[model samples]
Target: MDLTVTDLACARGGVTVLERVNFRLAAGAALILRGPNGIGKTTLLRTVAGLQPAVAGDVSMAPESVAYAAHADGLKATLTVAENLAFWAAIYGTDEVSRAMERMNLAALADRQAQNLSAGQKRRLGLARLLVTGRPLWVLDEPTVSLDVASVALFGTVVREHLASGGSALMATHIDLGLAEAEVLDLTPCRARSPASAGPGTDDDPFAGVTA
Candidate 1:
């Protein structure tokens, strides 16, 4: 499935932060969102993922086809690594738990509880949930936050494999991950105007005192 966004306007804290956002991510492709911090990148991803409503415009895709991963790991602290994967596998109706563990290099720590794992290990486990989701589009925000150099490279390989299998990814990140084929979409131009200085209804101030 392909992901498409046209003339999207999104808000954070009831204030618009991004507008005129447009993009199309076809199957087997990846699109990287680049912009400085607090530039509405997270807000855009959340809106696209359907976590929140768009202030205006359209996001074209089946909601079930998307798998969203945000800054939070969304892990079960008491569950073991393998168990966590198994839980997610059950939710997505996939039996790829073992495959996900091996792919994220978590097989060695399968029996360890999520809370007992190191930060990077936990991050890997959190990311492994994407594999079990069985969804075509991956919407990720800062996926490599806690990953080390080697782990980042490993994740890059996993992303490539996913694309090779006709999956699509829309991510917001500063790290390279070495995705040479991924197209870049800078959100600078899409920054919403502020509310203070404007005409009757035009919010032209980009800095609206809200975090993206």
Candidate 2:
């Protein structure tokens, strides 16, 4: 398995956000995690990315094998775009940061402060960070938010290319990404106490009792 999550559980403030979620993904594949608001989509992605302290589960992954792009930029406002790219590249020991920036259409913004860029620009820069990394697994949360239609189309292209390049992706997106042939993994019923008991506005969670 390129990625696997067995008996995973997540919590936030004593609320069960996810429970008993399990899956396996392979290289050169893509999977979409779909749900409505507050259904633990973001939480689940964080868990997969190892950013969130999982409540209970064995999430086996390749070390330094994943790159995550969240809804927030996570950019240093005081730093210029090139500075940001250089900083991340140096941190990751990569020398081809400029090429990644150019691929993300942020080369022109290289001298601009991250704070000064528009939301779309910031998101692009954030994505650039992932591109420059050599990680094999990608965990994206609402990647196309605040982007124009053109940018959204561009994102679909990027994702398709990434899949074609033998990379794997797990994404949580409310909007249709228009990927040519990606599979959808609906976790709604799997995360709930039971399918029959699950209803609208009811999202099943396993760590509902844990704090944070």
Report lDDT (CA) for all predictions. 0.88, 0.79
Where does model 2 exceed 4 Å of error?
194-212
Write candidate 2's Cα lDDT for 136-158 as tens digits.
78899989888888778777777
Q: lDDT (0-100) at residue 144 of candidate 1? A: 96
Model 1 TM: 0.92
**Residue 208 alpha-carbon offset, candidate 2, angstroms:** 16
TM-score of each: 0.92, 0.86
Clashes of 2: 5
